[model samples]
Target: MFRIETHAISLVRRGLMAALIVAASVLIGATVALAESHGFAGLEGGTFAMGSGKHYREEAPVRQVTLQPFSIQKTEVTNAEFAAFVEDTGYVTTAEKDLDQSDYPGLPPDLLKAGSMVFAQPKDPVALNDINLWWRYVPGAQWRHPRGPESSIEGLEDHPVVQVSIEDAKAYAAWAGGRLPTEAEWEYAARGGLDGAQFSWGEDYDPSEGWKANTWQGVFPSIDTAEDGHHGSAPVGSYASNGYGLYDMAGNVWEYVSDWWIPGHPTKDQTNPGGPSKTLAEQFANSAVGARHVVKGGSWLCAPSYCFRYRPSARQPAERSLGSNHIGFRIVRDGVN
Candidate 1:
């Protein structure tokens, strides 16, 4: 009788453990499904002047463009959203993968560890021309560890997930059943129904009162006044949304677009302009072989004296494989839903 009772208790405990495992799996599945259903704001896309003649050279030759109706995430992808995707898919970011010496020929073997570029502010004023003064390539600096191995996403669940390569962004978008926004689509949505405005909100940088976005204040690479109440990335929707009810379209982190980087805008009017088809190799034949993608909307590091790219027309090229703390992405889906 004693032997039978002991065996029965063991079987019951085993059954309870299996049941708990099944319950946990169900909870995880539910969480992933909930995250995949992120809200998107619909835009009645129409004709708009795509580029700006007043800003950088790349934005020149301002041309007209027409776009189909689409829906885009109201805010940039947050850390919590990305965590859910990773949990569901077991996806590993490029920054987390071991570095290939073949891709970085001259880099030392010791420096070939998995890592991502992180923004480190200098103690003193530095020259604006060289970005190395502020950007540091720290090992283990993936999205979860924005600064380095010591850092974490503890209180940053609501903050935009940074240090994500274009490939990583594409993977997340795919899992979410969406795609990265085109350059024209991103710019059009960023405009918030306002045509050819200098800034996403309006013409003035700091109109009437205080800072409207998370852009840097004071000096670049050295001091940040934090006039916008944030030194780095602010929580999504921390500031006011634009005319079309989209948030962080001007400043926060530079959001990646689906289009590749081109030197300048097209002269002729384009219907849903999708940028050039030429590979990064063809476009940068004279330079390095690595191709780059277009990243729009300036980051919190953008200052008036240095990178004044917080405007809607602003754009920059980011290397395809590299991820930086100041770079992130949002998703868009075609149709009016």
Candidate 2:
């Protein structure tokens, strides 16, 4: 009887262990799901005008595009969020890696340090024509140290994680079980239920009523009146959210899209138009042989006098291997389960 009782107690203990393991797994799964869905805003995507006739040539000849239901992050990926990914994955960003001298044939060996391009405001007024005047390639500048090696993200955890390359963005998206939004999807989301509006908020760029976004106020390259209350990149969701309840779609930082850089509009009305399947090098024979992705919206450097690309129509090419202080990204989830 004693032996039989002992066996029964051992079986009960084993059963309890199994139940505990299952419970722990369920809790972990719930935690991960919560983390992934934290900032995502669902959108019942539909057709919308993709580009603008009033913007740059690349944005001209606006075409209609239709998209399926999807979910996108309400705000750009924050530094604290990115830190969690890095801690979980132990991933190193491109800005943390040494520059490949082969890719830059004429660059000096000493100058090929691991860093990123940082936007340093000029002490005096400088020419808006040349962006090089204010933009500096600071060594040891990465997402952790946004300005340079000396800078730290201690107090800026809530701010968008800048200095992350397109590849890094993709990696983060993949880890989070999502992907970067296509150019069309990005524009559509940026529009925020408004069609062909000049700005994400509306047709007007007014800070007097209160800043709608984190864009340069006073002048380009030099004078920043801080009329919007922020001299540099503000924390994500600093301004009012758009119609779709999405924040920072206009400025704060340029966001990477999944599509490659194309100069012209779509050929026809496309349903869920993903940019050219071919890489930029393949699509444009004369273009540099590298991954050139489309970066949408604009950064804090964008001003009325200079680059007024803070609108939904504005688009720019960003090299995949490089990251900048003004560049970051948001993720999108296709189809709702």
Candidate 3:
């Protein structure tokens, strides 16, 4: 009789454990739903003229690209939204984790500590040719502590979270029941229904038309006059939304997209181009040491005289593992919901 009672208790224990797991899953789903409700602008996708022939060579060979309908976040994900995700999953960001020795083959042990690249504004004018003058690999720089160990996101809850690597962004998207938008989708949405337009808002960068986006008003790296009422990242949706009702698609931060970087776009028309499918070595000169992924949308660091990439067609390659102060991301769903 005692043995029989013990077996019944064991069965009860297993049942209770299963019940707890189901409850946890329900809570997670609810959290993600709340996160998604913040506003996901839908696009009934069609063929748009992608890339630019007038600007950077990387955005050259403009192609007629087609896409399926999709829904994307109206604004970049904020610190509060990311905080909820971290609280739910205890997720650790890439910059917070110790560097793997294998990734940095020749690096010294002392340099393999947790860190990320951060943009430090120079007090005086610096050389524009080399980026090393303004950008630094700061130890303990992560999304929560955006600047360094001394900084925190205490009051800037609404600001878009930065210093998140592509891997980190992907993890957050998965948790939120979405995925990173492809470069094609990002540009399409950024264009805001204005095909072949130079800027997301229109053809000109006229502040007289109204401060459409948060970008550098003065010289980059050395000085920011803040004519748009922002020296750095402003709260998400601080400015006017585009035609599709998407905010901050042109500036404020450079967003990560799910595309490996190549020098130029394809010469022919295509449907749902997922970037090149060639091996990493073939695409990046057969060298795997510094593989790069496409980062779209220029940041506050962009200036007309230096980096005029605050347009829909501009693109740049960033190291896959590295995160920076000026880089953040938004998410997209497969279809409009």
lDDT of candidates 1 onward, in order: 0.78, 0.76, 0.78
User: Where is model 3 more than 4 Å wrong at Cα?
Assistant: 1-37, 100-105, 278-282, 285-288
lDDT by residue (252-288, candidate 2, tens digit) is 9999998887677776899987788665435642234
Candidate 3: tens digits of C-alpha lDDT, residues 1-337? 0000111001100001111111233334443554665679889999999999999888999889999999999989887777777766677777776756675556666547777777888999987866767877777898878999999877667678898878888888998789999999999999999999999988887788789878887776799999998987988888988899999998899999998878788899989888876475145632533446788889888888888888999998766667788889999998987
- Shift in Å, residue 27, candidate 2: 22
Across 122-183, the per-residue lDDT of candidate 1 in tens digits comes to 99998776666677778788988998999987777778999888888988899888999999
Pairs of colliding residues, candidate 3: 281-286
Give candidate 1 regions above 4 Å deviation.
1-38, 102-105, 285-289
By summed lDDT, which 10 consecutive residues of candidate 3 come out lowest? 1-10
Between candidates 2 and 3, name the one with more favorable TM-score: 3
RMSD of each: 13.3, 15.1, 12.5
Ranking by lDDT: 3, 1, 2
Query: Looking at candidate 3, what is the lDDT of residue 55?
Result: 91
* Candidate with the greatest lDDT versus the true structure: 3
